[model samples]
Target: MREFLQRTLVWLIVILFIGLAFWAFSGPIEGLIAAGVALLAWLGFHLYHIALLLRWLEQPTAERVPDGFGAWHTVFMTLYRTMRSQMQSKRKLTNVLERFINAGEAMPDGVVVLDENDRIEWINPMAMEHLNLDRKHDVGNQILNLIRQPSFHAYMKNASFSQPLVLQLTQPRELVISVQLVPFDSTRKLLLSRDITSLERVQTVHRDFVANVSHELRTPLTVVGGFLETLSDMEEVDQATLSHFLPMMMEQSRRMQSLVEDLLTLSRLENSPKAVMAEKVNMQDMLDTLMVEAEGLSQGRHHVRLEKGCNQWLWGSAQELHSAFGNLVSNAVRYTPEGGDIVLSWKAEGERLCFSVKDSGIGIPREHIPRLTERFYRVDRGRSRGNGGTGLGLAIVKHVVARHNARLDIRSEPDKGSTFSVIFQRERSAEPEAQPENQA
Candidate 1:
């Protein structure tokens, strides 16, 4: 306002000077001088009036009614600039929203959208797969009612009007879903859901395995200790009976030892970071040693052969790869029929270095195949214990493969046989080590 008043004063003075010069040219010298003085007084009067007008124009239209064209100009330009800024902000927000929509739909997991009223608004491709949602019916429907889960329904009904609600999926399988509600305003809400089923399943399995293994080992250990105490108080027991008891005690101790060692190894793998500084493991050397060890364990009854064609080295911890490959190969030898042929093959498939241990064994059922890697999850518990299987080979294999940033594929059919494969990323050439035949 001060600036506008100053500009007006300057423009008004310039106009007065021009007017006086024009009027002075048509008069006598004394008269022209007098007219010039009159013009300066006229200029001051006009300048004061313009100043008052500009000050009134600059007053906020919301507080004062604009009474003239001059005042209206100020109000109109102020509103236009404010509207322009608001429009630009909305455009930027829309761009961000569009990008979020595209990224959310592209996700591999399920996603659902909800309006402020907790009604379904949108769903992603993955939501269609996991939820079996029919868009035509699901859209515009209340989310809690559509799911039809009592717990979820109650949760949403009593949900905090301003926050999110979480519900577990207790349907086809036990799945954990974290549902988040983003409230833009009291009348707007966005729902985001993430599937944590696999994570929760892993946690449950870990807990159950620990409890089961502890019980299994402790029971046998207690019995063996009791037998040793009885042996010490043998006042009339036969030596044959004592001898028989000793072997059983020794076998039980060995089983306990194997279980403890495998548990420790699994613990290490799990506690450590998933990504380690991967070193190049010579694929040929790795398989050759595994086959040799496996053959020795088989006592030459089951011939283990290695087919090596992968020039690429494996990119991971050599020790981890050895353990992963060794477990798979040795597991095959243990399960395969006597005198059966076990083939260990390695080749490069795309970016992955693939290795497989194929054996003629009692194959696993389709349902059990998914969980065979779980600790102590035996297809035949009696046979497994009788064969001196600690029931941790597959579990160990799983952890080792994960440490190596590799994938384990278990393909088997009933009675035909099973093939366990580990797919590893190819690495740069590694320094040559002892040929892939040494087992130490």
Candidate 2:
């Protein structure tokens, strides 16, 4: 509006000056003619500016705005400023959108965006892997056609997304995904997916653990109950019957007790914090004690020997190490046949120290080696039970080894022998104790 007034005032001034000049130099008729000519010239000037404005509007960029004279200069400058501000706002919005997309790409969970028609608008990298989607090909396609799960299709069609959908995918590897739909922008939706495979596995392991514990206890309880019932029924029992039933009941009771102790040990190891390594374990004494225990457990069946190749003590809990080492030694004695060799050795290899039990026992098969550390896992269940094994020995050993930052290696051959070694790193081995001074 201001530019319009300025243009009108300029035209009136030009006409008035031209008319006054003609009136002073000539007459009234000549002055009127001069005013008409001035009006035409003023129209021509405005037309030329209009042409420049129209040409610049073809591109409509701030940099391309044409220079103008008189009122048109102010109009061009205002137009340039408005265009520049809009461009800056557009660049800012573009940057924010890019950041949002980058965040989705970096997230561990999957994210998918769907338009009003349930067509794929954008999908993150994880979502592509979870749903088997191609960014180039799958975009703009209906998500239902790609997912193809009946439950998922029904979920979208119903639009009742109160609960997340648990989907088990077989292709692109077996995966368990928790999928949820969140509506946004009144029409569009965000599809979120999280991998819950590990959680599901843990829950399955918990259920199996409970079932196994129940099954293990029931047998011993049933045996004890049966014997008690028999004793009660027999008012005058014979000495032979008493001798047969009493020992059997005692053996089952002892077995149950062992199982309970092992379970408690495992629970403590799992729940307790790391073992304190301030106490230095005397490896020589510990190895000697293990040898004696192995011999006792052998009962003059297999020959047991201890090889003390290194005098270095260990920096760890003495009680836990004793338990771990004893378990391995006893297992060797129990499994080895009569006249077999059982050697318990403590030696240093380079910067590491190793405690190994090598026995000529019924060695494990190759396939069972990987799962030997799992609780209640036995290569030969019947043989293991006959030998009075609790099946939690290796699992306990594994935990103890881990607590001390050590590694347990097992090597075996069928019917030949098996060697179980616990290797401790340099950090775990302490220097040999100093000898007494000459003064004594």
RMSD of each: 9.9, 3.1
Weakest ten-residue segment in model 1 by summed lDDT: 62-71
Give residue 341's error in model 1 in angstroms: 2.1
**Model 1 clashing-pair count:** 1
Q: Record all residue pairs in model 1 with backbone atoms less than 3 Å apart, i.e. clashing.
A: 285-436
The TM-score, computed over Cα atoms with residue i paired to residue i, of candidate 1 is 0.60
lDDT value, residue 343 of candidate 2: 95
Q: Name the runs in model 2 displaced over 4 angstroms.
A: 9-33, 149-151, 237-240, 435-440
The candidate that achieves the highest lDDT relative to the unseen native structure: 2
lDDT of 1 by residue, 87-204 (tens): 7888899999999999988997677777777777888877755555778778988777677867667656665745444567655566577666566566656656677677778888
Candidate lDDT (C-alpha), each: 0.74, 0.90
Best by TM-score: 2
Residue by residue across 232-346, what tens digits does model 2's lDDT show? 9988999999999999999999999999999999999999988887998878778778878988899899888888888999999998899899999988988888999999999
